[model samples]
Target chain A: MSTKTETRKEEIIRIAAKLFKQKGYSAVTMRDLAKTMGIKAASLYNHIESKQAILQDVILTIAEEFTLGMASIQNQKASSTEQLKALIQLHVRIACHNPDGLAALNSDWMHLEDKLEYYLQLRNDYEANFRHIIERGIENKEIKNVDIEVILFSMLSTLRTLYLWIPKKDRLSEDELSASLTKILIEGINT
Target chain B: MSTKTETRKEEIIRIAAKLFKQKGYSAVTMRDLAKTMGIKAASLYNHIESKQAILQDVILTIAEEFTLGMASIQNQKASSTEQLKALIQLHVRIACHNPDGLAALNSDWMHLEDKLEYYLQLRNDYEANFRHIIERGIENKEIKNVDIEVILFSMLSTLRTLYLWIPKKDRLSEDELSASLTKILIEGINT
Candidate 1:
């Protein structure tokens, strides 16, 4: 694609993410996206192939970014505690950057027709890698001997929903948010 | 309403909750709901007024249940730690009983046209009560002096998303699930 074409495509994806986050994937139509963009629906088609294409672009890009972040963290020499902190920071930063896209990535990935399996694979792999880090934490005595699945589930639940919370909390810097989350999540609040 | 009418209305609501959870409130039409229930769309109107009515029923009912649960817990003489555990169990049990309704409550409450503001008030009140409990814990030194918002956010995020995880682990009883969550959430996992 030409530079202008690519820029327009990105703009379309951004607006579509906002709509998908608001009305959900199945409810958002190409015309709705075009209306939001102040472009004619026919003009939208000139830039993007289909509504599904917009969703695929919005979700896969964020999913891949997460996968890559996890991979990079996995290769580091940090302890599991540090590794988990890095993971939390990754989620917070990404969520702060594009909460609308993250919302689509969370709620609309199932709507990916041709790319459903690919998205699921990335999600499963990302989760598996997260669980591995927790398991290693237990083995290294960095974390308690709790049920691995419970710890994983609790942590993942909070991390996955960061996008919903980040937009409401615009005052906290990324580092401040990450540190607060790390302190609460990694270390229990019990005195 | 007569007992028979009430029963049929509830049945319609139950079936509608399932459809809403699967396809979301916006995507599931009255026809789709009626088809799922093996009834004519007109008959669906006999039981429930509209798709918005079904969503309002599903979400408002669950939200009210949480509100009531929190109210009862608030009157307890228990410590903050004990009260928080009760809150967790409340969420787990409610999610277990009506995972589909809970899913609708979480995701599709935005579609609760007439009841939207009421729902938002209930949600905000519920969070305020939760934060009050956490603040009490910090004051009593039951919980560490972490960011109250962070603790509240982390705990609520996990508790709110329990419906998404409960179905996959049917073997763990509600008590077991609640206990595991309490351990990881209230106590730090660090050794």
Candidate 2:
């Protein structure tokens, strides 16, 4: 695609991400997106082929971003504890900055029709990175060896849910929040 | 209310919970709920005042049950660790039994109107019990002193998410699942 065409596709994808996050996938329509962008429905077709196409692009973009972020941590030379901290920080940062994309992944993931197979695979891979870290931590004696699946699930699920309780205004600043959560995850309250 | 009236109310709540879980609150209508229940829309009013009423009841009932279950644990002679295990087990058991109610709380909770302040308060009290256990555990050197917010959030969100992942034919019984999760939460994988 030409530079101009690529830029337009990017803009369309951004708007669709916002709408999908707020109204859900099934509730949003091609016309609604166009109206928000001050254009006609046919004009949107010039930018993207269909609403599902927009959804596919948006979801793929988010997954790709997450995979890239997590991969960067996995390649690091730190201890498992530091690596886990980095993963948590990166995830929370993405959630803080990319609320639209986060919402799409959390709320609109089920609307992908038959294409969910690919997305689910990507999600499993993403989860596997976390699982690998926990396993390494246990092997290295950094974390307990209680059930690996449960520990991994708790860390990921807890981090993901920050989106629900985090207030737009009063949320912990990146450093403070990460510091607090990391301490809790690593050392229990016993002493 | 008479026994028949109570039975009718329970029936209406059950139907509404199913519809709300399947279609979400905004998409479900009284007519649709009535049709699903094999009753007319007007006939629904004989048992419940409004769709919101039914929703409020469903959520409140779950919240109340959770609180009562936790209270019973508090009254028991178990150690802090055992109490925590019982709490986790009870939560998974409820999720298994009332998957629809759990789904409703997960997805359709924001749709409840202003009249549900009492139910929301009940939720706060229920959460307080979880927090209390963690606090007590911390003081007694039974649990870690990590952020109660993070630990509590992880426990509830992870268990609640069982709605999406837990299958009926799973080899692990609910108690087994809870036992594994509790082990992970209270003890890290360091060993």
Residue range B89-176, candidate 2, lDDT tens digits = 8878887777788789878777788756776787888788888887888778787666667667766777677766566436767777
Best candidate, lDDT-wise? Answer: 1
Model 1 residue runs over 4 Å out of place are A1-12, A23-51, B1-9, B26-54
For model 2, the interface Cα RMSD in angstroms equals 2.7
Worst 10 residues of 1 chain B by lDDT: B1-10
Report per-prediction Cα RMSD to one decimal. Answer: 4.0, 5.3
Candidate 2: global Cα-lDDT?
0.77
Listed in order, each prediction's TM-score against the native is 0.86, 0.75
- In the range A59-117, model 1's lDDT, one tens digit per residue, is 99999999999999999999999999999999998998889999988877878999999
- Pull out the clashing pairs in model 1: A188-B188, A189-B144
Tell me the tens digit of each residue's lDDT in model 1 across B1-191: 12555588898888888888887787888888778878889987777777887788888899999999999999999999999999999999898999989988877787778889999999999999999999999999999887788789899889988898889988888888988888889887788
Clashes of 1: 2
Worst 10-residue lDDT window, candidate 1 chain A:
A1-10
TM-score of chain A for the candidates in order shown: 0.94, 0.86
